[model samples]
Target: MNLAMKISDHDVLLVIDVQNDFCTGGALAVPGGEKVVPAVNRIAQKFANVVLTQDWHPEDHVSFAPNHPGKQPFQTIELDYGIQVLWPTHCVKGTAGAEFHRDLDIARANLVVRKGFRRGIDSYSALFENDKRTPTGLLGYLRERELKTVFVTGLALDFCVRFSAEDARKAGFEVAVIEDACRGIDLGGTVAATHQSFRDLGISVVGLEAFL
Candidate 1:
């Protein structure tokens, strides 16, 4: 695990969904989510290009458990795209939960991509919505900016961070995940499964020291 990679201008640091809802004392908190803030802040300083992602869902978003009768949070239901995990009502637009974590330093970020805002669709990846067809415009933004590699970090490693890394690879960009700068929901062995997926996708899982 000798990651002696240099931080170049062609690389971008993608901080994904480090919002209040995913942190402590919010609607849908991931364990130790707030702990990522410091790690992300420190690593972000090494990158010249930074992009932040936010999960800004509508109140009646399809992924919410309350939107589906008799379904509970963490339950899975089939949608037009595929299986959708129901979440607690969280990160509603214009709400405090949708805002970035208070301790997350975003001053260096040049772009902020907001996803999951559509009432009928859910977006887990910064590059694409959950449907895998609907573009979030991030891929184009990166391409236009000539960013050849993407270093991802932030909340819920099993979901958003994992999906973002995969999509970034699928879109032909080199991708890596800063493991220590992320937290996970870890529903039913998802953390282990995500690691397997990352291996299969050729996504590097490095620690904060990779940048330090």
Candidate 2:
């Protein structure tokens, strides 16, 4: 690992949804999600400013099947919140699946951002919830601490990490995504296309070791 790079205390290292919900044996497991743990841990050890995001949702969250009528998991539904993607019932508040992955070193974390608590909206991104409407106070927290550059890495690069990186860019922060420290759910070529989209948006997509 590259311990030679100059890192500031203000540079925030954001770990998004590194929970069991997107890990192996979870209801909403992202393919290859478990693989990022070690890389993420190495990054955590190298960064002093570490923030972890959690998907803390209620059982009847509108994004879940039990709340949406005639909608099943993986289905798309248009609601007042905008394009909502229904997901499996996972990450219920205080549930074991909502906890951070066992392979992750949670001890190194400094801040915790808990999102997706509202029943009416689904929050795939740690920065903004559905439709870019709900601010998860992540920007404010980062701004208060004078953190302008954010390196985000977590489960499902095609979704959560992608969306979060976009919002981070929109929020006027420099964003970098450690591609190796993330997994994607694309059985098709969408993951590759999404990577290009991120490139188009000027989001730095690099391997975890690139920071070293």
Best prediction by lDDT: 1
Candidate 1 lDDT by residue in tens digits, 103-207: 889898999999999999999999899889999999999999999989999988999999999999988998899999999999999999999999998998998
What overall lDDT, based on C-alpha atoms, would model 2 receive against the true structure?
0.84
Give each model a TM-score.
0.98, 0.92
Clashing pairs in 1: none
Model 2 clash tally? Answer: 0
- What ranges in model 1 sit over 4 Å off? none
Q: Which ten residues in a row have the lowest lDDT in candidate 2?
A: 1-10
Clashing pairs in 2: none
Task: List all candidate RMSDs to the true structure.
Answer: 1.0, 2.3
lDDT of 2 by residue, 1-212 (tens): 24244568877888989899899889899977888999999988878899999999988898897677777787878888677778889899999999999889989888898999998888888888876877999888888989878888897788888888889888888788888898898745758987887878788776755666
